[model samples]
Target: MSAWLPIAPCTPRDCAAHEGARRAPLAAAALLLAGCALTLLGVACVPGVRLLAPSLRDRLVRGWAYAVVRAFGVRLRVTGCQVEPGRPATGELVVANHVSWLDIPLVAAVLPARMVAKSEIRHWPVFGRFAALGGTLFIERDRLRALPGAVHALAGALAAGSRVAVFPQGSTWCGRDGGGSFRPAAFQAAVDAGAAVRPLRIAYRTPERAPAGAAAFVGDDPLAASLWRVVTAAGLTAEIRVLPPIPAGGEPDRRALALAAQSAVASDSANRPAASVHH
Candidate 1:
């Protein structure tokens, strides 16, 4: 386990004062459209680019994510030990707490790993197409029969030296209660592939550096409403803390691996100052 270092805490007063301030909707819309265009263009070019340079497609996907983060005006700050991009020699699994839809771009902006998302996301208008082009692995959460196959596919990807990112909590949380308990099934992929599990903590803050509840997408929150809130917020920042990787060899089974990873994340979350607000 790594020591938890306290970053400067954002004040509630600062957050309250900035609540009334809003960015222009027209500007946000324009930026959103521009981002979508760039992403779609990148996706369209991937097939051709992949033929010439295999890695360039992944790089383009990452660039698209970076553009989305910037267009939304969200500041990203990463903490803790940094891990290099691409697959590691022993394989790697990134497990993180989920708070909002912003987590996707925020993670992609830094880490170059194929994300494991819910199957329904593949049908979500334009975003679905972008996700598929980015090489996301979709898991059918509602069908229990589909889980074993999904796990097997994930394991195969890892064994082939691909870094895979998963939100073991299965659903988004309000950044409260440590973002819910992590489900153990995903850990099996790590075990089967002999991969190390990396636990990451994601926190959102306002421009004033205060915890940002407005950025969280929880409950039955409409996607448009959440997007409007983030774009209109005075300022939003995503703070990502990457903890030490838990080696798979020592874990006796998937259950043990899952518990260890969850414990590490929970402990890190509890010790760190509550710097992000949730919806």
Candidate 2:
């Protein structure tokens, strides 16, 4: 497999563990309904994204992003390095470990940026419209030849002073044991554009801070199933830890920058070995 399609050992059976208190069925249903309503509102908001001034755009995205998670009953607690909410982060690359579908909105809650997403997502139901309206950069991961153009497009966006977000692990990992390796390919865009990289570490935990895997959206885990687990898990808190941004000149190259960002992200956690990917 190409590096863009890095394999993860995480599967729905092994990694998506149920943790934390669960909501009553009726309550869970209510939360799901709320999430759906917010999602519709978000889709409506996306068309205005490119029209609004940068500050208003960021504010709108950030607020709606937080509302999406909150409506689903996930309490978000952000910690560590903070950026001003209204200010635009020019030419910034926001990087985070992939854990669940929820990771997308979680990052947006921090900083609104052009998302580098799988091309398939651009065809997903209402989400496709949302992503397209918000100006997502879709990459054809299965087509290895398409990678260069994707990188060039990402570099171009950054060069235009637009903030961009990417999940460089290329696959989702359960945040326990350890998240999978960060593929260095996306970092090249950062290097080419001379953009700063903001390393964000994300974890879903209980209100008591125990690692919760109910949010893991790994191999073959249906989105509907994951959404059910998330909204039904009562007191689920998402830990959004923002590490210091790595300056554009901090590393000599993208490979080194990727490694440096990975080290910074994993430094606080005792990264135990995750299950290996079988060829």
Candidate 3:
């Protein structure tokens, strides 16, 4: 006989929860469509204020990101010292571990910075347009020849006083192993620009104060499935710890800078409480 005997039947509560999960994705999809439409409309009007009043555009994008996160029923909690708006006294490079698709909006909601996203995202329907309008820098990670150009562009952006956000891990993990190790290639921009690398830790928890495993986008999980999980997850909270910035100037090279930032992020993630669900 197989060790796995016959499966147990679902209880009424379990069935009801499953039904809710089925509906959550539909609801989230509707909200996303509406949000994208509004965002596009706002972007269309950017030309009027692009030069005279630039910050207005950034604020609009940030507001859209906040609305999208709230619509998904995910609560965001930010801790640690925050960098003031506008260019820092020194160049700034924001580094964080990749978690779920939600990481993009979560970071945008907190900070106004151009993201360095994978090139595949550039063709992802409405989101691609939105990201492009928001000044995202797309890179083909698989192409070795493209690294120098991307790095140079990133360095230029940082030197121009733009806060650039990058996920050095190159891929998303299930928030296990503290998001694996950070890749040092992206850190080259910081070294070239002499920017300060600020590490941010992203953590997720359920309403019951447990790890929100359902919210993790790992393995072969589809985008729709992850969205359903997030929407149906009760009181899912995303905790963002904005750890102190490490000066790139002190590092001997890009690899050293990358290691230092990775250490800072891992240490912070280790010290924080496992579950950070706010009441």
Query: Considering every candidate listed, which one attains the maximal TM-score?
Result: 2
Q: lDDT value for candidate 3?
A: 0.71
Clashes of each: 2, 0, 0
Ranking of candidates on TM-score, top first: 2, 1, 3
Clashing pairs in 2: none
Candidate 2 residue 78 Cα shift, in angstroms, is 0.4
Model 3 per-residue lDDT tens digits across residues 207-240: 5655566557764566766666676665777877
List ranges where model 2 is wrong by over 4 Å. Answer: 87-89, 269-279
Off by over 4 Å in 1: 1-20, 52-55, 269-279
lDDT of 2: 0.85
lDDT against true structure, model 1: 0.72
* Model 1 lDDT-worst window of ten: 1-10
Assess each prediction's global lDDT (C-alpha) against the native.
0.72, 0.85, 0.71
Model 2, span 51-87: residue lDDT tens: 9887888888888889998999998877776576664
TM-scores of the candidates are: 0.82, 0.93, 0.80
- For TM-score, candidate 2 versus 3, the one ahead is 2
